[model samples]
Target: QPANKVFPHFVPSLSGFSLTSEVKTQDVEYDVPKANSTDGKDEVLFGAEKGWLGTPIDELNRMPQCAPPLSHLKVVPNHTVTVRTDLLREGEVPVPYPTKFKDAWDDVSVKMPCSEKNLFPMETEDGGGVQSRWELIHTALQGGFKKRSHLTILLLQCLFFPTLSSLQCLELCEAQHLFEVVLPAMVSLALSAPRLCTLPIPLLKSRMNHSLTMSQEQIACLLANAFFCTFPRRNSRKSEYCNYPEINFYRLFEGSSSRKIEKLKTLLCYFRRVSQIRPKGLVTFTRQMVNNPPNWESSQTQLTRLHITCEGTIEDDGYGMLQVDFANRFVGGGVTGHGLVQEEIRFLINPELIVSRLFTEAMEYNECLIITGTEQYSKYSGYAESYKWKESHTDETDDWQRRCTEIVAIDALKFRHFLEQFLPEKMVRELNKAYCGFFRSNTNSKHLSAVATGNWGCGAFGGDTRLKALIQLMAAAEAGRDMAYFTFGDAQLMRDVHEIHTFLTGRKVTVGRLYSLLNQYSSTVCKNCRTTRPDESLYSFIYQKVSSQTATDALKVISDGTDTKNLW
Candidate 1:
């Protein structure tokens, strides 16, 4: 079969690849838009573009509606409400008193680890001393911690010497801080478990659009429970939580690697800060699903604006924009274990994000989790293996409905074979996944913020950066939003991608034309056994075809419509 017949209406002219009169090759002047100033004036920094700090987050879309109203308590069937509700009722009228506490470890609530009924006696090394878990927690709650208290000894035994034979991992200072500062705050937070979780948190199921909203105090309480290894049935793969990410802190504490120690420092720092002053604002976790996926080969959406840069990170420079979390299918990935990649690092900095793993099931291809209002607490330097925890970060960002940040977790396909991604179906899957994360409702279209993302699924997942970047751009365009792409210090990639974006936008290319071109490119790459050569790269192919072809040729591909047989 002819190449054009396999991918109809997408064959480049036989005149070969050359920049024609229609395609301008001169240096395109990219726009550097100013951020909205704090003092009611537009402020343009020295090298500012679309996603600077001064841009007010409040001016963007309104906060998503929270479920179960903050004032009332509603416990749905099958879901577990951890907090005691009887203490919250006032003369038959349901009222919310989040601080009111009473223990209820029934069949319909979270099994409180600190409850006296759940604790068991453990013998001491002296061959006589015995203490229950409740007594240890009670002693810590009462501020009776000493240098070598039983509670501290037990914690060290559980964390560092889980096998009772490994070398002690914590240094003197780290151990002291863990006992004196972190443990007390953690115990104090854990004590509020009965009051914090007032309603049965709905599980963010695989294919549902559900949102869970709670105050920072509530999240702190849950995290405290997780730190104590309190959440039941979460430790093993054979348990009911097999479909969910691990929520216990044991895996993080079990290892003795320098990486694990550094991660522990970051986590300890969060406890210290939250212990001093509990956050009052609200955070929401939303599971968004798309029932009707986009028609990638037929839709005619134009490319939105883009700010491509080689400097800064998604968390730092991409503030005020909807930031993307290069996540694992099981949300938090290996933050619980030793795995610290982009998603795990993000969760570590903002520990509140880890709570999502408790309820969020393994993600599907057409679903993404959007977390709003999480405040970053710790600043760190370096990537995995060389990771170090810097000093605490005081988040000064303004809040939108008591929320300071917006993050979307989108998991990409992890390929065992490098050539697997070259399949048309794989490309379409990625495109749909990105689209699901980026799409906003028509009502919020006017306030749709530019997506802040970079090299998603390009590292250990074996994805080509060029292909992933273009896929995100297409998705953002179809979703009617601009983008701020951080290349993570890849200057060549920044320039190359910016050049292609400039060329495509200058020629007024629609998404449909690009999708058809991608389909044709995938078919070509799959037929060849080897990976994409420099001359045969996606960017090179696009540049050659798009620059050489006329506007009419590109339009004809879209006008002819997508072949449904090939549409995945």
Candidate 2:
């Protein structure tokens, strides 16, 4: 249970309508974080994280609208509350308080006001800034949102990806779900509110194991299953050991020299500052150049797959190549480089590792591998490769890894935009079709039943096969969208169909209060257009059928099974 998790209970429809309910009037306040303990160091040390993150007026907007339309009061003898919306308030979102929404993850509170001023009240050192931790929690509580929740989600999205380095070195485990739960809901809610229905999509989890909305790669991958988890590469051949030559002397001179040389003999005051190499690919590996630290006379070398060296450089350049940040890679962390290196970076044919879906077929050819080693001496030893070159008496360049660095660049620009537009639209269109069939009183099909839950690929839910590779290409922080994809899945579970309407309208709505509110959609009409639309086509047809059977079946139970039509 030490692992982190977020449970999503609702996705809002954008049309901004509401269900029938007795209005509960209450004041609002929020919570925020503030500057507290000192560093106790010589001069106090502080970071920008405190300044921008803690609290602000813009951050307190998480509370849902004060009064939205309500769909109640017109009750028949059978208990079905016939919702009348003309008298309802406008734009309302109640903090969802689920009595039976399976496992609601975070804490829930509704007996108090929602605001940061009276919540966890705190001011800045100069009384210039403010913070509200309570406001953050209050935003995502009982109702659909609080401003702090929105702020929390935004911060995570920014960090989920970094344009600078592939080395992800931060620990933000708590903020994951604060953004994850609201993303798809907010997106779909924005889209469907006015239409009387909305399409549903799953959120994805980034490297932190916390869920997130969607990243560029994940969006593309889920859009058409064109991408999956991997970079392009050939498979390894039979058990063959690779042999990349060690670094030589001349190579040292080309390295940036920040750690300067000292008196005639100071044992390697010869190194320089590390130059950050900008990768043309999605993940940029910033290799820090540091003075070789003393390791008790012991020397080590890592067989890197690629490296960059200067042209016509000799072996005696007093330079060496190495790898750092390997520890962070081996240990568990968030999902930044996982898509590219997340899986066991080994041969799929070996069968000990999960094959990268992107390269599974391609791995059958052009296999590549790396080999390396290191040696040290007690006294003055010229550059490493210099001696090797002399010992061989042959003018051969012993550079393999560095030589592998080529000018070839992979084209993945369209991956993000394609997914952003494709997946959501595909799901929406499909869900819409399903909605049309079941509700019109003229057409309902049992054939669409499979949409409630199904599978698209190898995942437990309606798995999206393309998301793996595409997400790998996205920067780390925002990649959590895949987790949401798995959890929320396709409407029919991505089986015979993988769109929105097929899945949601197909399943039995399990939330009791949600059902009651939705059931009122049977006779609800758009005030502006005078067009009647229910939450779902089937729900509509059933409502009409059941309303006709009001004298027989208990209308209250039926009404409780539908969605309130207060949505625009």
lDDT of 1: 0.68
lDDT of 2 at 34: 27
Model 1: residues with Cα > 4 Å off, grouped in runs: 1-177, 396-401, 530-535, 551-568
TM-score of each: 0.75, 0.14
Residue-wise C-alpha lDDT for candidate 2, range 18-65, written one tens digit per residue: 112233433322122222211211212223221111112121111012
Give the alpha carbon lDDT tens digit for every residue of 1-568 in model 1.
1211111111122122111122223332334443433234544542423323333333433223211123444344322334334543222212224445445555433445555455544666776544555555555456534553555455554333242111243445544655566566788887766556655456777887777666667788889878866665577899766888988887775646767766776776677667777675566788888988789888888887677776678898777678999999899899988888789899999999999988899999899999887888878777898676665676642322344578999999998776678688999999999999998665345566678899999999999888898999999988877778888766567667766776676566789999988877767755664644434778788878886676445566668984433221
| Whole-model lDDT, model 2 | 0.19
Which pairs of residues collide in candidate 1?
A: none
Off by over 4 Å in 2: 1-353, 356-568
TM-score of 2: 0.14
